[model samples]
Target: MNTLLLRPDPGHEKFGLGPFFRVEPLGLEYIGAALLAAGYPVTVADLRFRPGATAWVRRTTPRIVGISCLHALEYDRIIATAAEVRRAAPNAFIIVGGHAAASYPAPLEHDLIDAICLDDGEEVLPALAKAIKKGLPLTEVPALRLKTDHGWVTTQPLPERTSLDLIRLPARHLVERHRSGYHCLLFKPVWLVETARGCPHRCSFCSVWQFYGRTCRERSLAAVVEDFATAGDSIFVADDLFWYDPERSMELAAALKKRGVFKRWILVQTRTDLITKRAEVMAAWRPLAKDFDIFLGLEAASDSGLEGITKDSEVTDSVEAVRLARELRYGINGNFLVDHNWGEAEFQELWDFVARHGLQRAGFTVLTPLPGTEFYEGIKARIPDQPWSNFDMHHLLWEPKLGAQRFFELYAETWKRSILNTSGEKSLLDWVRQVKPSQWPYIIRVLWQTQRMMKPDAYMTEHALSRAPLPEPAARQPGAIVRDEGGQP
Candidate 1:
């Protein structure tokens, strides 16, 4: 049977760091590897290219179509893509799965979709395809919410978490044609390497831990070393927690060194406390790359703010992490969550922290209530109907305590403190010096698009567009101006 896997272009990539990075769909590639090993012909199409879902369906003529939904903001787009696939390949068995779809299958439980994979696709995809190929009931497949004539029904659960070693190396050959397009910042033709899966930390604003049941799984050290040695010079490690196990991490680093693997750049995401406690493990891995960068979740500037979000780590850990990484000659890229409830003092505190630590490279995001988390469940009913795109963490989902206009002004001001602000410390010339002449055009375009985050008007305009008008009162004076207590018409 011929199967097609798709990675849809996030429908709303106009804002945030969307313009800065575009990595390959490592998840679909892994699934494709599994299917191919099962004797199924597989085609992985990245929908970001021209000739979209409908076109790909006609060309591939696939018996099974898998669509990826990685973010909550892409929910609407995924549904629309499913409809297109349904029209193009009416007989195709359509399934949607990824971090988003599996975590909260409710958004994807539509007639257009045949099932939603509630677990790792590497195991689920092969089994689902086998069931269909053998003319067996899909109910026999584990870890799925299968669609039936009656309604969507849950299938038997997987006996255990899907092992990461199922596929030694992803079917990267499927996406090789688009390799040059995959990048992070100045690193073109980047390779995405996943050494591990899942996160154990529970941050209220994040859905990663909840989706994976707070479990961290690692691939075999040999598989990881092979992947690192064979991958491109610039790699982005897609692990939710990069150094979760200090011993395993040290072993992996030593294994890679033994294999004589080195890279131009490697980026990994980990927690602040991890860096503080496992400084030796970090030091051991430093020799693997010429320029290694760590993306730390410095979610807040104070202990109280961190505690409020159940971050479990204090502000001092963040300080020490930055100090240690810099001392070890590792590039640091950190992010902080900005709450809508924050007042002027809160913003000032964050700004002070950033300045004091010389962390202008740190990015900021609005504390969004992402779907499939406790945060979203608590506030979903209160929020008026809005596009899932607004949940990009750049748009406001509700009226803020400081009001929309003022809130956006502070938000935009916050972004201006970062190094992306070309009008501030770094100029166009400074950015140009960092890249080759051929890359200048691309870098300039990215910098130009990033400027939108520093403008209050841009955010406010999008915010106003997403908001619905309030219903008028049943009775009112003829010339009366109806306004909330905060004032203004």
Candidate 2:
């Protein structure tokens, strides 16, 4: 059996944090590993680089093609890539899977796609390939939404959650050619390592918990230690919750130290409450890297705001976490959600909070009702014709209470308060000096591209171009008090 896995060029990466991060497709690498172990020849191509899917398909001539859809914003690009693959390899059984595809697959249920993997690909893809090789009915394969004469219908669910130990090591060799292209901020050639999967917390704005059913699964200590030992010096841990289990995290830190594993830089995401409650665990892991940064889910500025979104943690937790992490010498970079229903007062409150805590590193995003969440289910009917590209959290799906223009004015001002605003506290030249002369070109290019986020006109243009006409009631009744969905007004 021959297999081809692709990480498509997500077309909507020109805005927000897109330029700041571009790591390898760790999911496809793991799936490719499983296929290789099962005696299938595999080729992993990141279509973000030169030579698109058509070129790879012509060269590899694969029997099966798998495409990843990690974010909802990439839905359009994924479909276009699938069409291109179909043209190049008409006989290939095309399957799509990843966070977005598996969560709400309705958008990807097209004639070009043969099936969608609704679960972990490491187990599902190998099993799917085996059935295809044997000419067996794909309906027998578990965890798939298979295409049939009738229509797209899901097959049986996996007997149990796939173990993290399914593949001893990811098939990173497949993506080695594009290693230097992978990065997070100034860390070129960075490695993405996953010590765990799934998040236990249920933040209403997030889809991770809803998709994974609030279950947290960790890899074996030995496996994690081995991964860290062999990986590059700069690593970004892909865990949704880095310290969900304090004891296991502490043990993992100890195991890495025992194996003599250290890094130049490491970045991980976790909740402020987790940091405040599990201070000892965080302390234990701080020494793993010379430059350790923690990305906290600082979702709100006040207790009422946090409660409205069901974050379950208080604003005090965020304050304390920032204090504690800085005390421990861990660089802090977090984000806060700016609600569409917010007024001038609300925006000012967030600004005051950021200034008070000295959190210029924190980023801001509009409160988007992402697919695969309860929030999206409640609000999808309101905006039926909006393009998926606008779901990037930078664009508003519906007109806000303050209207698009004023909302973007305040939104852009909020961004100016952050360190990303080159015209603000940090000059473009200062950012250039931080990196080596060789990296200046890359740094300047990324910083210049990021300036679009600071322009209200840029967002307004994109919003008008991508959005459909507003609903009749909302349009007829301007300046009406629109109740906020999934949060307080």
Top candidate on lDDT is 2
Off by more than 4 A, model 1: 467-489
Per-model TM-score, in order, reads 0.95, 0.97
Cα lDDT for residue 68, candidate 2: 98
The per-candidate count of clashes, in order, stands at: 0, 0
Candidate 2 least-lDDT 10 residues: 473-482
**Model 2 agreement with the true structure over 1-489: per-residue lDDT tens digits:** 679999999978767888889999999999989988888899999998989999999999999999999999888889999999999999999999999999989999999999999998998988888999898999999999999999888999999989897665888999999999998998998999999999987887788999999998889999989888998999999999899998898889999999988899999999999999989998999998999998888988877788767888999999999999999999999898887777788899899999999999988988888999888887788889888898898988777878889999999999999999999999999899888898888999999999998999999888779648865323311112123544342
Residue 470's lDDT within candidate 2 is 62
Error of 2 at 424 (Å): 1.0
Looking at model 2, residue 319 earns an lDDT score of 96
Error of model 1, residue 357, in angstroms? 0.5
True-vs-predicted CA distance for residue 342, candidate 2, Å: 0.6
